[model samples]
Target: IVHGAKRVPQDAVSDQCPEPDGFFADAEQCDKYYQCSDGHITEKLCPDGMVFNDYSTEYEKCDLPFNIDCSARSKLQSPQPSEHCPRKHGYFAHETHNVCDKFYFCVDGKYNMITCPDGLVYNENAGICSWPDEAKRNGCSSEEVFQFQCPKVDEAVAATHPRYADPEDCQYFYVCINGDTPRRNGCKLGQVFDDQSKKCDWARNVPECADWYKGRLTDVQLAELENPPTPRPRATKVSKRKHQRPRAGDDILV
Candidate 1:
């Protein structure tokens, strides 16, 4: 019984703080820090060769040694350095653990991370992403990655037959309809689209044609088939008169 008065347990200190726009110390862990922005918080760990310094000012927040090569560490790596990430409308190497298959699109220095969809890769030579097979066939290096979706066809071409070979898939094609999103279709086996004939035909017959074939007729061909030319009327046969004694008599009278 050795106490002047029983000490009351102080209420647990609140760890809450105002919203932050930059780096700050972790509320529970001294070795960690929180990256705050837009009323959100993200836990982060220092990159390799860096350490968390709590005394850093706002301008020099997340203070780490100046000698550390922070840029080498990808954005996916913990405690992303502010300097290396791409700004708005700019492109940068994606943070991928295995294949470099993704890229970040900084919208106004924030927002989305754009990537090539399935069956595609980014092409650096074209300065945009594209299908890997296309890029390779087009002589683009394997190292470069780029791709994009089908764009609107030209007005002149749109009014005509809208068939176009797909650069991504040889077996697939795009059929533009009234300048809207092109309809995608596949070619039949053992046939291909014949540009000269403007129809799908046997691959053996049209070696220069694309790999896939739809076997569908164009609008003009269909119209011609529907309205065929009418046959001309046959000439009437005339009877010839007998030229025996009548001929001799007619000559004498004349």
Candidate 2:
């Protein structure tokens, strides 16, 4: 029974003081618990991925036993001592999280994995992620799988020659004036970038060939195109043949 600001016992109305700070299990709910503080009781539930830590100083809170040290507590529901996580080879922590912009190497069971959200790779020396060009200036290798795919172009070239024809679209080309975002531009009608000549020409005159060629190929050049070499089969051991002397009669007949 409760009176104005104090809780009174059922048998005696005189017992009106509030309870001390402590954890108390709820009577009706198994997953819920009560925290008594300053004569007032408040109900709370542990957060997801964690369980109530009755032995903690703040007994109402929840935590992973292995992650917290509860040795000072006299009564612990389940105490778990911290142990070393085994060394993982080649496997990085961020890779498990499906993040490609940053990488991590485990050391002594713990690693701090950081990410470069600006389409850059993490530089170990600089302790931050930076543009590949800037990373190179700082003497750091800019080799990482970026979260986004951006064409690799030299800064000087990107600034001067920002427009280039896309091989797939003879009538359209891409412009990278900002060195980041690309814009598409269409060529004039009746003409397209000649992949063979590397210049605008009649699409009908351009021979059907790979776009990588810089200029039109002659008949001899077309015939000289090399094919990819086929993979060779693995060699197998051959039994040695026994040597025998040639027959004298057989040699004379030969």
Highest TM-score: which candidate?
1
List the candidates' TM-scores in order: 0.23, 0.22
Off by over 4 Å in 1: 1-156, 209-254
Per-residue lDDT of candidate 1, residues 1-254 (tens digit): 01112222223312332454665665444334555555355556543323355565253233333322233332322332334344333354455422344565443345455666544555533435655543343332232332224456788876773666656654456555554434445666554565556566555566655333345555444445445568899999886966566554465654
Error of 2 at 138 (Å): 33
Name the 10 consecutive residues with the lowest summed lDDT in model 1: 1-10
What value does the lDDT take at residue 65 in candidate 1?
37
State the lDDT of candidate 2 residue by residue for 151-240, as single tens digits: 678787767545556656666555554555444446454456654454666444655523323365443443443333567999998889
**Model 2 stretches astray by more than 4 angstroms:** 1-150, 195-199, 209-254
* lDDT over C-alpha atoms for residue 32 of model 1: 48
